[model samples]
Target: MEIVKGSGFIPGDLLSKINSPSDLKKLNEDQLEQISSELRQYIIDLVSVKGGHFGASLGVVELTVALHYIFNTPYDQLVWDVGHQAYGHKILTGRRDNFHTNRVYKGLSGFPKRSESEYDTFGVGHSSTSISAALGMAVASKYKNLKDKQHIAVIGDGAMTAGLAFEGLNHAGVENANLLVVLNDNCMSIDPNVGALKEYLTDITTSHTYNKAKDKVWELLGKISKFGPNAQEIASKIENAVKTSLLKQSNLFESLKFRYFGPVDGHDVVRLTKVLADLKDIPGPKILHILTKKGKGYKFSEEGNETVWHSPGLFNKDTGEIIKVIPKTPQPPKYQDVFGHTIVELAEKNLNIVGITPAMPSGCSLNIMMKAMPDRAFDVGIAEQHAVTFSGGLASQGLVPFCNIYSSFMQRAYDQVIHDVALQNLKVIFCLDRGGLAGADGPTHHGAYDIAYFRCIPKMIVSAPMNEEELRNLMYTAQLDEVKTAFSIRYPRGQGVMVDWKTPFKKIEIGKGRKIKDGKELAILSLGHPGNLVTEAIERLKEQGINAAHYDMRFAKPIDEALLHEVFTSYTKIITVEDGCIIGGMGSAVLEFMADKNYSARVVRLGIPDNFIEHGEQVELYEECGFSPKKIAETAIEILKENKQTILKQGGTSLHDKQA
Candidate 1:
């Protein structure tokens, strides 16, 4: 690693000469094109070792270089939608030195962060937010009379298909905002994009008649401009009339009132730079449709599975083989894979069961199920709001719909959850993957609020599985006819503890919890995968002569009240732990339950705090947040010492008993 970094990692590279957009401006079109190649190589080399987002960044290398070269960024507002593609943007914008440290603990963030750099005008992780954000910046600039400050939203074709993107387009078109929506059409967003917009864009790109007619109309309009002021007015009328007729069959952006520009070669940095420079003079909301290959430079990434290459961990750059960090012992499958396998297993038995993922079939491992039951499984592209309501529609019939979405992405459709599913009392099962510290992807991707968000909604049953076996049972139980309310099963990213996780399925009682250990003095109640951490803490505490009782309270919403009553009665010192934010999470629910029951037990809540947690390894983040095994053990010991001190201070009359 040191050899790779020290041996002219940047000094020999073209990127070393370019620090900021200013450096990019110094280079000619040819030099800039050369720099784009260098930039792509740099990303591949670094990401192959560091392992951040792959294909998206690779796809946008030329576009990133062109945008930076053409626009005076930092001074001008440049918003990147789904900032995963902004790796080249990060490198060009004074982060080349720290780029290798990407997505590491306390290192550079994988996505764009406003606090990280001024050039990153809007921080992003989730998709389809760029247009609205860019428009907001553009509108603000307009209000301030900063006409020269260009606000460009570099969004992918997949993000462009999102409903929010259209909402931004609608407003920008009406307001005539100076916003440039650069549509980076690679026809992919994690998985290949689906739905009407992709098809429409494809049709426009392929149609020779549409392009020929549009080009002819523009030529006539340019010729009319040569006449005079009266001739120019006539040209404008003729151009709009011709464009209206020609574009009606082709352009959707024009229909929304945006002056649509391209289908230009995105990889050609010189061409892209020229187009962008020309677009600067043009007024109102505009879209530049640029076509680029997803994994342009790398043969491996281009030829290999694009979905797998999107964010594959460390890999061999030359051979294109993924480098697996193997443990001494066999490791368990990822929680996503577990969910994928479980859903397929359950779906096989139940004919009414259908699987749905919002443009995340590959991400959530729902492709495994999709492959098995193509008709039954659906990939609704980048539309969380629609996905929720669609699931409600599916459940309106007797069919059981398992709507799988990442916990962070699921936040986009909170209103839909309330209005469409919960209000309707639809028995739609929301399988929220990445339901904890979504490491490396950072705070934007963390599933920190789902417990808080879903538990509060009336008729919503929120459940988190401790292991793969439990996850299977919860899915099985959720589909039961007796369960008529909206159900949510949230699980963390990465692997579970169970190696032989394919245990025989059993019917788990809803709202019930199981006691893991019986001990005196203190009782530990844990929710979800964090229970594995708590159990480890308990084992380590036993060595210190501290016997702490433990309970795996699976259900966060209809929490084990029966178990809590027993816990409050038996144990004076209670510790409630979860993987979610403490404010309105599982721990808070327990506190509320204790208060309602009038139990005066001293409760210590251990979980993520009110603040947003940044990216890192999950265990490292857990430790920092005071929820790791070592931290939990230390906390338990401290609690025991405090209790012992209070008893000693009270002259042997236990304060816990007195309080109780």
Candidate 2:
């Protein structure tokens, strides 16, 4: 690393001079190996302190360096599938200095943002998008008569399992476009890749039969010079004969008309650069399969659990020890963990219950049940739509399918939810994790829309838990025979409220809300974990001599109309808070209820605003969205201070957009 008259350390020698791909172009191909090392080290340096994605970028150091070195980025179009491994790409493309701010509030985003850099062709957080996106750019390039332009989609093998990726590949093969799909086969996503595709890829990547055939063909090509002009044709024929026999069914990419290239070493920067340069000259759609380890360089990440190292918050780079802050007291368990344990408990009692997740067993803690009862759990790889539909299939039988999906990812499977599950009126327990603002991942990952989206769906019971106990109760209730049809239980990413959350299983009556406080002033209705915020806000309001009523409105769909009626009759002033969008959310349901009953109340809805919320801490994002305890209290105080008649005239007549 080099100081280079800067405040902090920057990239070393070859890397520091190279501001962009143009600068990288100035260096000889031989120097790229050194640049790759420096880039890898820099990523390690920054991510260890700044706390962002770790192993993925380390794994793709060579690929990122080689791609930038070979292609005309910001022009040729290089799109990373998920941007988990694009840290090196960002650093090389004019973000080296500012890389420290990665995933920080108002700093560079954790994932690729088109607005952040011209080089980042697509704004990506989700996987399996690069192939389709790059194919679009390639088709456009062909239309524009830009012959020299190249469009490359660097996708993980884990992402390859998605129907979208296959759809893109199927389309790309038919299109006459200068496109290259670099399959970075690490045999892992966040967790190890699953399904038949992983097995097929494994066979291709590590089969003795394929390896022997490959060596024999290479040897035959080397000795082909002994023959004459027909040697090239003869060699090609021999290679084709061997490939046809061995990869009869396994040659999936080739069957789609893509000129499939080797399962090459992705870490070999020199070979990679050479192959990429050569492919750019050869037109049409093709795929280059390169095998890479998830955590390629760093010792700890390379040896440790790839999933844990995928986004290991912080670490000691020298010692290889992951940083940890040991709290004095036992903290509350993560909501996912609670769900993991609770599901196992339920599945043990009910033989018909099964768990399902799309490429996120560990992330959502489904891995716990997967380990406990292997037959009753599945990890569908990076295919949210498939997971939902597959769960629906399970529901078609007598089995109760607990389909766990992240709230943000569930958006991808909206069609499946509506058509496959909801429309069929199947008993699919949709356990939507990361239910609210997923902090630090920004708009792409925030679980702000599930409440609105799920609530709108017919026969879908949209619900969120205030704490772990509620999560357990809700999970227990959904599995029961009483809760028919598609039921969704949304919960946030972090820890729940209660430390002793492993309470006895209890059943919660659907649509019935619980009152936390009784007050004279406005009533505060909250949905999900954000109800805790209302509790704090109500306490704050009392300090200011204003008493506020609070209700934990658990279910958004069959919303507690009776409970809402009780509150409406008692208090003319109301504040509805939720960790979801103000539009079409629980608050909206309250407004709808108010209008339906022909009641007048000053309804101030506090939640995520109309705009996209950026990356930050959970607290910071809560404050930004104006639903933090402080903001909630302030909004209530303002509402309480105003004259009853004037406030009623302004807001009581209809909904108040306090968020707007």
Each candidate: what lDDT?
0.87, 0.87
Q: State the weakest 10-residue window (summed lDDT) of model 1.
A: 1-10
lDDT of 2 at 596: 96
Per-residue lDDT of candidate 2, residues 134-197 (tens digit)? 9999889889899889999999989999999999999999996999999999989999999899
Q: TM-score for model 1?
A: 0.95
- Clashing pairs counted in every model: 0, 0
List candidate 1 segments past 4 Å from native: 1-8, 11-13, 211-246, 326-328, 655-660
Could you estimate the TM-score for every candidate? 0.95, 0.94
Candidate 2 Cα lDDT to native: 0.87
